[model samples]
Target: MAKNTVIGFLGSTLDASKRDSSRWQKWRPTIGLCMQQDLRVDRLILLHGEKHESLARFITQDIASVSPETSVEPHRINFDDAWDFEEVYTELLDFAQGFPFDPEHEDYLVHITTGTHVAQICLFLLTEARFIPGKLLQTQPRRGQPDPSGSWNAIDLDLSRYDSIAQRFAASSRESTSFLKGGIETRNAAFNTIIDEIEQVATRSSAPLLLMGPTGAGKSLLARRIYELKAEKHQLSGPFVEVNCATLKGDNAMSALFGHRKGAFTGAVADRAGLLRSADGGMLFLDEIGELGLDEQAMILRAIEEKRFLPMGSDKEASSKFQLIAGTNLNLIDAVASGAFRDDLFARLNLWTFHLPGLADRKEDIEPNIDYELERYAAAEDTRVTFNKEARERYLAFATGPNAIWSGNFRDLSASITRMATLSPDGRIDRKTVDMEVARLQRLWTSDRGDDDDTQLSAILGAERLTRIDPFDRAQLSEVVKVCRHSASLSAAGRDLFAVSRQSRSSTNDADRLRKYLMKFGLSFDEVRAR
Candidate 1:
C-alpha cells in the first residue's frame, strides 16, 4: 500500500490549451496519467518554465478537482532553450540531486511522454541509472475511442533482470580483465583473480591504489596498462606521469614534485609545472613510494586530500587533481613502526592494495609467460625467432623447475628471451644454444644469490678454511647457512636449500643431503647453528 509518486515536465501545449470548463475533455498526458484505471497517484512533481507559471497553477487545480485525494506539486526549472541538451540535463540532474526523494515509503514513476526528446532521454537515463529511483511512465491517447484519460504503461529499466544483456556485460568484463593482464591468457588462478578485481576497482573508483611487490615484478608495467585502459574509456583527459620516488631526495625532490615559482631557489630560472600538475586530470604513479622522505610524505598526504599544495618558496598554493597509484617493495607497516613512514598516508593508500607475487611463486604460469616473452622479442626486433622442438622442451623444463628463482620476476624472463633470440642462428634456437643458455643462467643465478660475497663466510670458517674453498663452493655454502639460520629446524632448512636440486634426484632426502654436504667441511647442522 505504498503511495505512488509521478515526476514530469508540464506539457505547455496540451496542458495550456485548457481555459474553459469544457477543456477537461481534451486529452493531456499529465492529467491522463493520473486518471488511468486502478492507478492512484498520491503525489505529482511537475517541472515547468518561469513563463508557464499560470498554466502550471491552472493544471494543478484541475487535477485537484478531478482527483481530490491526489496532491499536485509544481517545480520551476527554467533554461533558455528547450532543445539544449546540456542545459536541460543539468537542470534536471540538479533537481534530482536536491529533491528529498522518499523511495522506501513511496513508489516513484518518471513521466517521459511530456518533456522534449532531450529531456526525455535524460530522464530515462537517470531512471535507468537509479539516480531518480523510479520506473518510466509512458502515456498515449486511445486511438478509436474519444477517451479523455489515456492508457499508461510502466517500463522497468533494470538491466540485470534481463539475461541477454547481463551475459553481454559479463563477456565485456572478461575482455577488460584480459586487457588489464596484457592479453597473455595467463593460467594462474590467483593472478587472474587479482587482475579481474583490479579491472573492477579501476573502472568504478578514483581512489589511491597500492601495489606491493618486489622489484621488476611488473608493477610499472601494470600501472601503465591501467592508465591506458582508463584513457580508452575517456576517464582521464591528462597525461600519465610516472616518477621513481627512490631517486628523489632533499630540496630538489620537493621542487620536482610540487613545482616552483621563478626565483624560488638558485636553479629556479623559470616557473615549472611539477609531476603532479603534469598528471592533472589523469594519474600519477609513484614507484618505490616508501623511499620518500618524511617531509615529502607529509606534503604528498596534504596534496592527495586537498588537491592543493604550496610549492618550493612560493606563497600561493597550486592545485592538481590526480589519481594516485603507489608502488613499493618495502613493508610499509614495518616502516611505520620504525618511524620511517607516515601511518595516515599508509591508511589512505592501503584502502585498495594488491600484492603481485614473484615469478618463482607461480611456476605453472612460466610456460605461457615464456611464449609471451618470445613474441615480444620478435615484435621488437622485427624478426621471428623459434626454438627447435628439443630445445623448446629443454628450456621449458628448466624454466618451470625450482632452480629458476626468477629473482627479477618477468624482467629476468624478458631479458633471457631477448638474449637467446639475439644469439640464435638463422632465427632458430637449437639444443646447443639451449645448453649454453642453461649453463649461463646457472652461473648468473648463483652469482645473484643471498650470499654471493665470499667474505661473509670467514666468521664461521676462521678465515683459514674459507681460503681453501672455491668461490662456487663458498657462494653455495653461504646461501645454505643463511637459510638454516632463518629456518626453525634442520629439516625445514634442508627443504629450502635443496628446493632446486632435489627435483633432479631419483629420491628426495633433503635433510640427509644437507647433513652429508655439511660433513664434507668437518661441520654439523648443530655446529652451524652454534654460530
Candidate 2:
C-alpha cells in the first residue's frame, strides 16, 4: 500500500493557543487533520514563511508526541505579502516545481484548511490543474466532541464525478457554442463542430486565430462573436477594432494599421492610435488579411509576436498588446507559394486555422440560416416578415437546387431574403412573392456569371487586343462567347444570341449570323467554348 503524505501550511492562529495546556484541549485544524482515526499520515509537508518557523517547529514537535508514526517535514515557502495573490501563487508554483512528488508510491493530500485565503485559493488551483499531485484534505472542528481532532474529508478534483457541476459546465459550453454560431441552430455537424472548437479556444487562449473562408462566409461575424464572448468572460476590456486590409494602400496602409506620429506624411496633422493600439487589451479583427501589402504583413507579424511596432515616421517603437483574429478568403498557402504572403507570418497564424465552409457546401444549414436572416431583417427594419409554408418550401427548393450556385455564399442568401422580406405585400411571403424572388435570384446569378466574360474574353484576345476593340463590339462579343460556352452547338448558340432578331425574319438562318459575328472577332464557336 502507498504511504499517505499530507501537505499544507502551519496555521498561525488555528495551531497556536493562549496557554500550553489549552493547546491540547482546543481543536487545531492542522493537528486534527493528521490525527484522524482512519487516515494514516506517514509524512506531513508543512509549508510556512520565515516568521512562522518557530510555530512550524512547535507544531512538528507536538505532532511527533501524538502521532509518532507521522514524520513532519518543514518546507519554508516565503510570501512577500501573505494576502497578495500573485506573490502567493508565484511562490507556490515555484515550490510545486521543485517539490519531489512521488504519487505512484505515496498518496498525497493538500491540507487547504490551514493556509491564508490567498494561499488556499492558490493551492486549490495548483491541485486542480495538477501542478500538485494531490487531493484536497479539509478538516473541520467539532463543537462539543471529546476528541480535539475534528472530522476530515478528502475532495476529489475530477469534477466529472459531480453530476450537477458537470451538467452546469456542459450547459455553459452549449450556450457558448450557440453564441459563437450567432444563435442559429445550424444543422451542419461539421460547422457546429468547428464552432464548438473555436469557442473552447477563444475562451481558453489569447493566441492569434486565422479564419479562412470564401467571401460572405461569416468570418467577420464569427470574429465579432468571439470578441463578445471573451468580453462576457471579462477577458477583454478594450473595444473591438476591425479593418478590411484590402482598402489599405501605399503610405496610407502603414499609417492606418500602425498609427502615424504628427507630420509623418502630408495628410498627417496629428497623432493617431492605430487599430492595433485601439484594440489593446481586446480583439482586432483584420478582415481580408490576405490583401495586406507585404510591408504591412511584416509589421503585422512583428506586432503579433512582440506586441511592439514602430509607427510611421516615428523615432520610438510603440506597444499594443491585443488578440488578433485574421480573416482571409484567399488561399494563403497559394499566396505564400506565389511570394505574395510571408511564410513566417503564415506559420504564426497557422497555429489555429479554421476553414469555414461556403453556403453551397453547407446547404443543409440554409433553412435555419434563412430563419436567422429573416429575424435579423425584422429587427433591423422593425417589420416582422415571414414566408408561408409553400413559399418557404419553394425558396428552399431553389436555394438548394443545382442551378442556384451561391457564389457569394451567405451574402447572396441574405440579399435574397432581404429583397423578399422588403417586397412582402402582407408582411407574409406567398408563393407569388417566392416566384418573383426565385426569378430575381436566377437573373442575379446569371448576370454575375455573365459579367465574368470580360476576364474570359481578355484572356483569349489578350488585354491589349480587347482594349483596341470598340466598347460595343467587346461587350457584344463577350455575350457571344458566353452563349457559345453554354450551348451544345453553333446553331443553338445563334438561336440564343439572336432569339429576338430571328423572330422578325420570315426565314433566317441563326447559325449564319453567329458564324459571321464570330469571324469578325477572328474566333470560332469551338475556340470560344474550349477557352
Candidate 3:
C-alpha cells in the first residue's frame, strides 16, 4: 500500500437528496466498499461554505451513519466576509495552519462539499500552500438523476492529478532562486573558491563544518544555498533543519537539540522529538554556535563524533546521523585560548571552515542588493514602486560614504530600503529623508560606542585616577596622552602640543612636572587654563 496518500472529497452539502434517507442507503454501501478494500481512514475534515445550516446538519448525520468509526472534524469558512485580498489569503492560510496532519504519520483525507467559486480557490491555494498532500474525491452531479446524491457513486481520485497539483503548488511558493531571495547569484573569485572547497570537503568526508561570520554576512543563507546545490548535485535525500543556537541557551537548549523521554523534566510531561532526530538523514544548521555553553558544546561534539547520544535522562542511546553546519561570529582560536570554549570541540568542527566577508568588503554588490530589495518589497506590498535615478544615486552616495558603518551589513541595508519605500512622499524618496535617517541612526550608534569606550577607559585609568579628576576626566582624552602624560592636570604647557581641553587631566605627577615646565616658559595655571 502507498504510505503517503491524501484523499479529498468535494461536493455540496445543500442538495435535497442528501437530506433524503435514500442517500444514506447509497452512501453506506460506498463506505462499506472502502472498508472492504482495507482502506484505513483515521479522520475526516468536513469543510462547508457560508450559511448552509441545513447542508451542514445533513452532512453531519450522513457521515455518522456511513462511517461511524471515522472521527469527523468540521471547519466552517466563508471568503466573502474578508475585506481585501490579503485578508482573504490570511484567513485561508490560518485554516491550512490548523491541519493536524503529521508528515511522518498517516496520510490526510480532505473532504470538501458545498463547493463555491471562492471555496474552490481556497482549495487551490491550500494545495499550493503545501500544507498537506491529498488527492481529490469529488462527486459531480450524475446525468438523468440531475443530482449527485441520487445517482453518484464514490470513485477514487487519480493520483496523477494530485501530483500535478502538488508540483504546481510547490513551484508557486518558491517563485525564484536568485540574489533577490538571499541566494547566491554570481560568485566572486574568493567566495567561489570557498564554495569549491566546501563541496569537496562535504563530498569526501562526513565531518561537520563551521562557518564563521559576523551577523547579516549571510552565513545561514549561504549554508542553505550550499545544501541546495549539494542536494541537487549529489542526490542527497533529506530535509534541512536550521536552528539559531543563540536563542537556545540554558537548560531548554539541550532538549531542543536532542529528543527527550517522557517526564524527563518539568515540561517533559510527554515524549518529545528533538530537532536532531527530525533532521535525521538531512542537514542540521547550528547558527551562533559560539553562544553554546561548555557542557552543551561537549554534547554536540559527542553527537558529531559518535553519531549517537542519550536524550536527557534516557539510558538508551538515540542514533542520529546527519551533516552539521555551524556558524558563529567569535574567533574560536581566541575563545579557546581564553578558556571560554572547548579546544578539542573547536578542532573537531574546524576541520572544514568558511569565513564570510562583510558587506563593506563587497561594496560592488550593494547596489544590486538594494535594487533587489526594492523590487521584493514592492511585490510583497502589491504596489508599483520604483526608485528614480536621483534617489538611487543619493542612496548609494550615503551608503558608501565615510560615515556609513553599517555594522548590521545586509540586514541593515534591507531594512533601510524597506523604510524608504514605506516612507517615500508622493512615491519618491529624496536626499533629505535619507540624511535624516542616517543622522538618527548615527546618533544611536555613537551613543552605544561611547558607553563601551567609557567602560574600557575607566578600567584602564584605575579607581585612584578617577577620584582626583573631578569634572576633568569626563572630557575626551587621546590614547597616547592618557598613557604618556599619566599624572598631569590641565595646566601643562608646551610639553605636548596637541590641543587639550580645560577639563583634561594627565596625572598628579605630570601636573607638577607640567607646572614647573610652564613656570620656566613664563606660563602659569591661570594662563594655561585660560587658553
Provide the overall lDDT of each model, using Cα atoms, as 2-decimal numbers.
Answer: 0.86, 0.89, 0.63
| TM-score of decoy 3 | 0.51
For 1-531, candidate 1 gives per-residue lDDT tens digits of 789999999998866674886776778888888787778899999999999999889888888887888899999988899899988888888999998988789999999998788889999988887889999999999898777787989888887888999999999898888888888888889988888899999999999999999998889999999999899989988889999999999878998899988899898999988888889999999999999999999999999999999988789999999999999999999999999999999999999999998888878888888888888887888889999999999888777864566887888888888888899959999888877776666556646774444444655665435545665787788888888778888899889987889889888888888899988888788778887
Cα lDDT tens digits for candidate 2, 1-531: 999999899998899876577777889888887788999999999998899888888888889888999999999888779999999999999999999999999999999998899999999999999999989999988767766799999999999999999999999999999999989999999998999899999999999999999999999999999999999999999889999999999888898899999999998999988888888888999999999989999999999999999999899999998999999999999999999999999999999999999999998999999999999999999999999998998788877766566888999999989999989857998888877777666556646777576567766775434544665776778777878989999999989888998899999899988998889888888888887
* Model 1 spans > 4 angstroms off: 1-13, 19-27, 34-108, 115-133, 140-153, 450-531
lDDT of 3 by residue, 1-531 (tens): 324333332245334354455664443322332233245445656554566556656655665665566665556766565335565557767777786656665665443333555555565566645654554344333445433243223323443457777788556433333422354343455655665566567656667889998898888877787677557657456789999988987668989988789888888888867888877877899998888889888988999888888788688889878889999998989999998889999999888888977777667667777777877887898764566777678668667654456678888888888888788746767766665556554544445467554343344443223322333333433332342344354534333443453237654354566556445434455443433
- TM per candidate comes to 0.72, 0.80, 0.51
Regions of candidate 3 where Cα sits further than 4 Å from its true position? 1-189, 195-206, 451-531
Clashing pairs in 1: none
- After TM-score superposition, what is the CA distance of residue 29 in candidate 2 from its true location, in Å? 2.0
- Give lDDT for model 1: 0.86
Which structure is stronger by lDDT: 1 or 2? Answer: 2
How many angstroms is residue 150 displaced in model 3 relative to the true structure, after the best TM-score fit? 69
- Candidate 1 vs 3: which has more TM-score: 1
